[model samples]
Target: MTRSRLTPEREAELYNAVLDLLREVGYDALTMDAVAARTRSSKATLYRQWGSKPELVAMSLRHSKPVDISQIDTGSLRGDFHEMVAQSDDCQMERDTALVRGLSRAVHENDDLLQALRELFIEPEITGLDTMLQRAIARGEIAADNPALKYLSHMLVGAFVAHPLINDEPMTQDFLRDYLDAVMLPALGLPAPGV
Candidate 1:
């Protein structure tokens, strides 16, 4: 990939424009021309930086995430997770959910998109969660090499998708706390905070 001479500020603008267009028009419908017009950059620049629509959107999705999973420790696993969950920005979450909804159809059929989603979106969060689990194991809170370690992050994220589908509730902090107690902790052989 050719290096972009664009400043960090300019690069962020392009990423934001890509996500904004993805939310508005979706992956298949989102054209490089539209992104260029929206970001006020030339089509040649975007093509040079990202090479294709899939690559542009992939890079945008990767950049949108808060990649710093540092500073998550609060001693206990549940405590760490509660802190993580409590940090949710509802508006951002809603935007992300909408982005997924918009791209779901095309994502499933397109190999490039599926690879991008896993590499850029899914793997980073999972890596963060895996780091958290490793910390807990070091503290003797969780057994090292526990099988549940692998699926923990997926389940935590999947809960958000499942909650709205099975019930009429949004993933408010209160409900997620309950879910942590009722579902997550029990599955990992950990007790809820008060229990």
Candidate 2:
């Protein structure tokens, strides 16, 4: 069965159903049967569209989001960084949590799934951050080739997402602010005023 057989509307409905299931039951517990039941589609239809569970999950995640990397001029690098940090205080966090957990489970077990997710979900965010940093450089807010910019992307997100999982605490806005001020900005070669 080819994707051409399924209308665009039908595909979107099925994908949205998968996202809903992901939010409700998480990735580990999600199953083709469950998705079929939730979407009111036959399991064979899902199999035809996506050969395996990981493939289905990967496709669902790819379709479920529009990555936002818009220019946010906050008048200063600090303000821009703060705005960027603050943007994650919504559904994006929940989606990232689910994607990270799901991808982590699959990374060691399934190479194809791991590669698909790295290409689809992870690389885009990294590239977007790089673009943001480039814009900052072009604006003279930072050096054109700041070394810390090379690492700020991972530090900003990894600290929030990975550290909490390591230490067993929920990520919060205050923690995000603290991390941005103490870790991210400094790493990006920006110090607080009069420092």
Work out the TM-score per prediction.
Answer: 0.88, 0.75
Q: Residue-wise lDDT of candidate 1 within 18-114, one digit each (tens)?
A: 9999988878889999999999999999989888788788788888875445468888888887887667666766676677667778888789888
What is the lDDT for 65 in model 2?
Answer: 54
Q: How high is the CA lDDT of each candidate model?
A: 0.80, 0.73
True lDDT of residue 60, candidate 1: 88
Poorest lDDT segment (10 consecutive residues) of candidate 1: 62-71
Give residue 29's lDDT in candidate 2 (0 to 100): 81
Count clashing pairs, candidate 1.
Answer: 0
Judged by lDDT against the true structure, how good is candidate 1?
0.80
Across 1-195, the per-residue lDDT of candidate 2 in tens digits comes to 368878889898988888778777766688899999988889998898887777777777777655455465666777866777677664566566665665566578778767767776667767776777777788787897677777776686587568568867666666677777887777777885458
